[model samples]
Target: MTERSRHLSVHVDRPVAEVYAFASDPANLPLWAPGLGGPLVHEDGAWSVLTPHGRARLEMTPLNEHGVLDHVVTTPSGERVHVPLRVVADGAGSEVVFTLRRAPGTSEEEFEQDAERVNADLALLKQVVEAGAAGGAGGPAGA
Candidate 1:
């Protein structure tokens, strides 16, 4: 197998829309994602955020109640890889699951390392939304 992937899951105790809205909206990313410090820069629906590690460019494509944020990130060694955010609603809240797959020729260890970071980020996301941050139209700020 040339590619290796890992999936991580977390349950957020907010309404599905609330969780979805906050996580999908680029502007609110920085608030929930402390590890990805600073504000998010969006252009043509793509968001660029600076993290403790460096920078990540996300291509957001949102549909009615479903969306995916395609991520382009540079590893410590400066190699670029593509990751996807598959967001789906579950009952009252949302179950966010991230699948991390390595590019062809990349090793599983590298993919796991990256996936760990992604998992940690999602864990933080769950904490933020479940702790009562996600609420209204433009997120908690507008609430």
Candidate 2:
């Protein structure tokens, strides 16, 4: 029942702030994330989604100058899992990293598959942010 972790990253050809502005919004998850994403519902100040497993809540970090996009997922059974995410500057572009931790009882195959899924999610995030930037969205010029 030991916990293990993996990290996946993607480089987005966009400014850090622009990437953070888009990726940090939980409501935009379904546009990028694959398995875990959904048409999220916001009620009572918390974002909830009807996950395949059950109803789950996404509690993201507060907006800040730092590019910390960390959040916690609370399962229907009250199990809380911490998802460590960050968007940081890389020259004029940015790099997004997602840390996926295998819960106490997850199998090895499941953990590996989870890492792959997270990688896909990060790639999707990069695509979404870059597409937004190319469309003259995300922020003002040089923002």
Candidate 3:
């Protein structure tokens, strides 16, 4: 089966290092990614979150200088999913991109939905980071 990936990127009006610093911190997940950002509990070498679907475990990449934010998400049914994320320098600002893969046997609708979700999350990330860079607290995006 050929693997297909969809990329969604957002430009944040902040330095690449600053953006990576904030995004690489798992603690800030809830501030930008509301969907997957819940209270995380570490148990048995994995971070667990009570997702609406069920209990899910996430293993994200450690803080690194290469701007890699990949993560492994395991569902309650024991399915392991890999999500590739990156942050790169874009002139005076930063560009954050998320790669969503279309799993084998996944329906087209499901893939589109996944892309939409990622887009919304990226938008939130851009808003939060830009707001902080503008000397404002992390308020609602576009507020």
Q: Taking the tens digit of each residue's C-alpha lDDT, what string does model 1 give over 18-119?
A: 776777776777766555555567776556766667666655554344445555655435666565665555666667878766678767777776677777
For 7-70, candidate 3 gives per-residue lDDT tens digits of 8999988877778878877667877887674777777776778787788888889767678889
Question: Top TM-score: which candidate number?
Answer: 2
- Estimate the Cα RMSD of every predicted model relative to the unseen true structure: 5.1, 2.9, 5.7
Ranking by lDDT: 2, 3, 1
Q: What range of 10 consecutive residues in model 2 has the weakest lDDT sum?
A: 133-142
Residue-pair clashes per candidate? 0, 0, 0
How does residue 31 of candidate 1 score in lDDT? 68
**Model 1 weakest 10-residue run by lDDT:** 134-143
- Residue pairs with colliding backbones in model 1 are none
Candidate 2: how large is its RMSD? 2.9
Deviating ranges (above 4 Å) for candidate 3? 42-45, 133-143
